[model samples]
Each structure stands twice: as structure tokens, then as C-alpha cells.
Target: MKNSEEFDDSFMDNEKVVLQSIAEDLRTCLPVEAMLPSESLAVEKAQQNCKPTVHVDAFLYDEEAVDLLCEEGKMSRDYCLLCGSHRTAPLGFISHSFSALELRFLFQNVLPDLSGKMLVDVGSRLGAVLYGGCLYSSAAQLVGVEISAEFAKLQRMVMEKYDFTDRIQVIHADICTQTSLLQNADVVVMNNVFEYFLESSEQMRAWHCISQNVRKKGALLVTVPSVQEALAALQGKNGVINIHEWLEELPLDYDVYLGKDTDPESFKQIHLYRVL
Candidate 1:
């Protein structure tokens, strides 16, 4: 028991150091918003297509990071209701990636040993999961499929800088076209993948494609906001057939504490599933 505790403590420290380094490198490379031109345009169009809202990509800025930004006068938590008035409305923030903290919780607590397994991250903006997987799990391969060339290039730069090429691969292609990769993956991770990047119609197509291809029995699927929630929004409009036929939701323990600053609610947004 003592040995295991010691190992866990040491590992956590190492993990924090590595993730912090990655975050710093990313901050230096990207702008404060961390939205590439293509991503910003897509978000604009998607917002126009659906409900318009502010989305802060979680990979680049977690709640704590946002707090730091606010402290530094780089970001704000609320906007003024009147230009000169003190009255303000809190900004509704939406995150587009599995945050760094969430990734730690996911790999350390949620997933089983991934040695010799392949994990694919759909719409891996900034390769958060891939880097987390490389550091936190023993997954033999981590693949990220991104439609944006610019995002893909940025991720590749990080991977190369950190020497993650042996296990990490970024494919610059739409996930709707990567059925074969999905078929072979032992684990598939979607962090608002289609919903954030694709139009409602496109998201529908992407989900259907995922459902049909990610059919390897016993394969795991990790998603933010649960797959059910995602499918429900597209039920009548997008023809997202029931996912229950293909997958089963796995309950997660939410009480595990990673830090004093970690938000339990954020962790709850993560859900796990298995191919049935």
C-alpha cells in the first residue's frame, strides 16, 4: 500500500510538470484565444447555423487558466451590460476540448491499462488527448484526425517538438472519411468533435459515420456531454439514429479529487462507453 501510494504521488507530480510544460509551449505558440483562422471561421458559421455562443477551447485554457488570464487583464469573466454602467452579465463559456485537468482525471482514473491498444481522437484540436495519452497511459498509438490543415500542422509541430512521433500521428482529414481508422481503434475519443466543428447536417453525418465504423466489440468511446445528449439534439433534424444499439454507457466515479481547484462539474461532463 505504501509503495503504491508513493508511486502515485510521484507520478502525479511528474504528470503535472509535463502537462504544464506542454501548456506553456502552446501558449507561446498560439494567441490568447487559441482559435486558428479556420476554426474561428467555422465557429462563426456554425454559430450562424445554430445558437450563437462564446466557445473557449478547453485544451488551451481550463477554468484555472482562464482565471489567470483574468488576473492578467487578458480575459474577462463578464461583459458590461451598459457601456459605462457597472451592471454586467456573466459570459457563458463553452469549451471545445477535453481540458488538461480533465485529461489527467480521464487517464489516471477512468481508463484501464491501454498498453498495446490504439486510441483515436476525433477533431483533436491541439492534440490534448494525444499528449495526455502519451504521458498518462500506455496506449501504443494515439491518432488525431483533424479536418483543418492549420490545426494539424500546429499539433504536428508540438508532437515533433516533444518527440511524440513514435506513438502519435495526426491525420489531416475529415473524420467522416476515416471509417477504416475508426474500425481499427481500440478507443475513440470525441471532445465536442463534430458538434463544435461541423454544421448540424455535417455533425449528423459524422455521428452516423462514427456509429457504423466504431463497431469493434469491447472498444471504448470517450465523449464530452455524453453521446446521448449529442444524439438527442440531432434526433429529428439530423437523423442520428439511436446509439444505444451500438454502445453502453459506463458509470464513472465523480468523487475523485485531483486538486483544490479542479471543478467536479467539469469532470461530470465526461462520459465513457463501450461497444456492445
Candidate 2:
């Protein structure tokens, strides 16, 4: 037990160092103007307009009090692996921070042209994508589709907080099944939300909807957690998983750009698909 305690302390120390390094990198890469306004505003909007979390356990856990020490390579049993919560609700500060990094990467590398075109963010949560779009591009229309009414209202509120309501629109609809509602868009983004649909058929349908909705030459930016992470969860541990085979299974309408992080197990792996 003494040896185990020492090992745990060392592991936590190493984790802290890595996290600090990442935080520095992010601070350097992401612009100051690209971040969310304030936590008070976000929390207030969530509390007032978003779904009542009092009822949903499908994606909620009192992480402050909950002690579920996930073993090395083991899944976090306290939260939903797909949505990162036991309940289907808005994201927290940590999740938003990670997402902002990915968004910075997207803005810098993936879709450089954000000016004068309509951009659609399927499953946009609390206007994060809209904020990214507004920061990165001068796109005429930044439309966001969210299935959860609570979330849609919160996104609307968030847009108002940024005074971007006139430019960004949040619709209450599911993009997967309601393809007709999604008109042709120049850029369509689905960040870290694709893996939620565990069924292959559902994934295929989502692709179809995205393909049909996007312009012929438009760009599609989607993020999937590293295969290693997915495997680790199932095996009660985490590691990096290759997406080569996974890309092959996706629709042939677009050529997917695979992103490889220096550390594969960091959940930083991303894939970008541009529709042909």
C-alpha cells in the first residue's frame, strides 16, 4: 500500500506537468479573443435556460464529491464516455477548454475561409461553434442545430450574451433525421459528437445527412476521439487507437484528413473530411 501511494503521487505529478505543458501551448496558439466571455454568464444561462439537470442522470455526476479513481487505461465510470457525462447536458469548463483548443486547430488548419459563407454546426452546444465561427470568419450565416430544447434556448442566450444574435441562429432540431431542415451550407462542423451514436446504421445515416446538406465543394470538420481511448474504456483502460480502418468505413463522398498527435493516448487525435 505504501508503494502504491508513492506510485499514485508520481503519476499525479507527471500528469500535472503534462497538463501544464499543454496549457502553455494552448495559451500560445489560441487568441485571447477566442475564449468564452465569463463563467458567471455561462452558468447563469445554463441554469435559467438550459435543461433542468435535476432530472437527468444519463450524463450527470457530482464530480466534486464523487471519487471514482479510474485505473490506468481504465474508463471513467462516473461519466458517459461518448458525451463525457452520465446525462445529456451542456459541457463544463474543462471540456470547453479542450474543445477550444481543437477549435483553434480547426480555424488555423482545417477551414481557413470563414468569410461570406453560411456555416452550420450540427449539435452546437451553448454557441461554442458559433463563437468559433464568428471569431474565425466573417461568415454571413452561422446556424446551429441542437436537438435538446433546453440547450437550444441556452445557445440562443449565449449568442445574445455575445451580442451575436443577429448573426447566429440556433435551431431546435436533430440534424441526423431532419436533413431537409438543413439547407446547403459552405462549412458543416460536428466536433466531438459523432461517437455518441454507437449504432453503425445511425452513424451511416448521420453521414448521409451531412453529405446531402453540405455544398458540393464545402468542407466538413468532425472530431472523433482516438480509437485507443475508445478501446481503453471497453477494457477498463485507455490507449490510442488508429482511425485508418474507421475512415475507410465512412462515406466515400469525402476524403478524410487524419490528424495525428504526438501522444496518441491524449485524446487529441482528430479527423477532417472535406466533401468532394
Candidate 3:
């Protein structure tokens, strides 16, 4: 095996191929409308028992390919039964899953070692982080906690299809309810979990809950937006929860993962923190 310092573009290229093959298999059963959580039986069944019946695409880096699989036209609207008023859209109204490249950067650079460790992805929609961990690290266990049952089912289906059941598991429960899981995780990844998916009150409660439960000292906490930025957004807001008390900033040395084709500035938004 090559040392971490010896990693290069050749390794990235090979990993990309493996990742793309998995994505291509998922794309077959995952239509655009089905990308978001849905209660449709057809979509659920298709995802639950998906098989790779077609050849994997040679190039899976194009986000447009995924978008093209979606249903065309405006999304359907919902109305309240009592007052006939419009209600808020579904949980996945906005897509929050990380791109393949971002996942690569995170596992290869931000977290280069995961031997015998357990990783948990909060709000693990579409299981992007979980899949990336399996491919890029030697973590003993990879778990995804998704509140959406539909999304959880999709994740399990994909895992089953890829025969990763030994290392990957998806729990269909809210992250707040899984405090024990959080407490025991060696690495916890929260990718835009609170920004759009949660309400202000829920976000505050979640931060509080996490601070109290995720008490494993020195555990890694990865977030997309820097901790400062996340807190600054709630500076003047009422009922803001301070997470800095429980987490301390950890500087990341990610230069080793950068190459001519990769821009260091692109990852400025990525933040790493350690449990205090």
C-alpha cells in the first residue's frame, strides 16, 4: 500500500471510476422526481430492489445527467385540508446531498485515516457520505441517520445492491432520537443538516442535543459552512444555541490532497472541528 503522502491523481482516477459505477447503477432506478423523498409505492419498490441492468456510464461527473433524470415541469403543490391553504413543500424541496468530488476531498484530505473507526452521517440523504466513506477509508462501520423513511429505504437498497451491508447501515430515524449513536461515533459528518432541512427552533435544539450527547472527546465534527459563519448567521436571532462550548476549531492541513486540477480555494467553506 502507498503512503498517504504518495497519493496522486492515479488514485483519484481509479476511485472516480468506482464511484461513478455506483452512481450509474443508482441512476437507473432513481428518476428525477424520485430524487427527493416520495411515498409512491412504485418508486419505493423500484429503489428497494434496484439492480444494475444497464452498463455504467463512462463519465458520471456531469451533474446534468442526474438532473435530466428528474420529472419535467413545476412541482406539484399541496394544500391544507381544513382551510385549503398552501402548505410548505416537502423535506427535500431543496437537494442537499454532497457532490461526488466534495466527498472525495473530504475523505481523502480532511479525514485521511479511519482505521477501525465508526463514521456517522447526519441527515444522510441519498447516502453520499456513507458511500464515499466505504470507498475511501477503512472505517469499521459506516452509518447514515436519515429522518426520511423513503430516503433511508433508497440508501438501504443501494447498499444491498452493492453488497456493502457488512459495513454500511441506514437508520430511518431522526438524528435527535439517536443520541447513543452520535455519542459513540468516531467521526460525525453534518453536511448542511441545519441550514435548509431544519427550522430555527429545531436547529437550536439539535445543536444543544448534539453538544450534550456527542461527548466523545476528540471526536471529529465535519461541517460544510465554518462554525463561525453558522453562528454569525444566528447572532441577532432569538433562542440561538452556542455550540462553541462543546466544540473547538481544528485546523485542517489539506494541501496534500490538492493537485493542478484541484483548487484549494474551492474548499474554503469546508470546516473541521473537534469535540472538547
Best by lDDT: 1
Among all candidates shown, the one with the greatest TM-score: 1
Clashing pairs in 3: 32-69, 32-70
- State model 3's lDDT: 0.69
By lDDT, the better pick of 1 and 3 is: 1
**113-143, model 1: which lDDT tens digit per residue?**
9999999999888888999999999999999
lDDT of every model, 2 decimals: 0.84, 0.48, 0.69
The parts of candidate 1 lying over 4 Å away from their true place are 1-12, 45-53, 238-240
Tens-digit lDDT track of model 3 for 1-276: 353434653465666676777777666665434344443432343344333111112123243553443334322222234455554432212235655667778888887599999999988877888988998889999999998887788789889887889999999997889999998999999876775556556676777676778789999989877766766665445565566677898777656544434546546567888888
Q: Order the candidates by TM-score, highest first.
A: 1, 3, 2
Backbone steric clashes in candidate 2, count: 16
**RMSD in Å for all candidates:** 3.6, 14.5, 10.3
What lDDT tens digits, residue by residue, belong to model 2 across residues 1-276? 433544544443332343333333333433322223322433343345333221111111123212331343222333333555456434222233234334445565556576777788777755566766666567888898876676677567556655787789988876876565455676666654444323334444565555455534545545454333433343322322233322322222222221221122222355555554
- Looking at model 1, the pairs that clash are none
Per-model TM-score on C-alpha atoms: 0.89, 0.49, 0.72
lDDT of 2 at 229: 43
lDDT at 115 for candidate 1? 98
